[model samples]
Target: MSLKIEIHSFSYKKGGIPKDNSGNGGGFAFDCRGILNPGRVEEYKTQTGCDIGVQDYLETKTEMPKFLELVKSITSINIENYLDRGFENLQINFGCTGGQHRSVYAAEKTAEFIREKYPQATVFLQHDEQPQLNSSLINDR
Candidate 1:
């Protein structure tokens, strides 16, 4: 068989990073805000928690007009590497203020994007709201 792509969606919540919350080193701990949009990330500084504009970090952000460019640069490279090497599965994250709104929407959109971009690959989303990581894509890991 060739390769098959899967799309897993999870609600993303804004936070520093996900820990098992334990100091062990088992779960995920990636900071999506700062990583996806570097210089533009300061927009969150004044806000105490979860600014909705984060979704538009791409459509907005005048100075760094390439929000998707930055996101893809950080994520796609890693995704492609796994695929090129013939990995069976991969999981990716897209975090927003709350798992309810922007993050959820973006996660769905991202899953769609990945499915279309890499038809042969399996794309999955693990938003912050997920009680556990990779509830669906867990097997891939």
Candidate 2:
């Protein structure tokens, strides 16, 4: 099946501090920091050595474990019903207080999770209120 997913990659301006209790699969809190300030490219590269945000927040456990679970649940639902599915399209949305900071970072991490678990599937990133890329995705033409 032609699988497709939409994953929004955001920065720090819209999404406020992310919370863990957003779903029923409640788990321990962990900060999956997705910080990559281009201003300090050299330093950041030296600190982590990996370009992907996944390597940056190499913490013991992620604070937003529920986010990961949420994604897993989606995949599980589809896989359970094998041939029944035609084209799998999942939009794992991550909404912090705004749409930046933790939410954006979490979204990135979530994308990685989905890719690893559900390979050979399409993924897309959609930020609701991205202050960085202001291209007017909300306007009437």
TM-score of 1: 0.47
lDDT by residue (tens digit), candidate 1, 1-141: 333333222233335344332233332222234334422357554321124574455345432235435645666775677678765544444454444333344455555666667666654455456444335552243
| lDDT at position 85, candidate 1 | 78
Q: What RMSD, rounded to one decimal, does every model reach?
A: 8.1, 9.3
lDDT of each: 0.45, 0.45
Evaluate residue 114 in candidate 2 and report its C-alpha lDDT on the 0 to 100 scale: 60
Q: What is the TM-score of each candidate against the true structure?
A: 0.47, 0.47
- Where does candidate 2 have its weakest 10-residue lDDT segment? 22-31
Task: Give the Å shift of residue 111 in candidate 1.
Answer: 1.5
- Estimate, for each residue in 1-141, the C-alpha lDDT of model 2 and write its tens digit: 656655554323454322323242322222334323322444433322123442344222344455456556765575335325655544445544334445555555665666676566655544555535333432211
Output the lDDT of residue 23, model 1. Answer: 32
Candidate 2 TM-score to native? 0.47
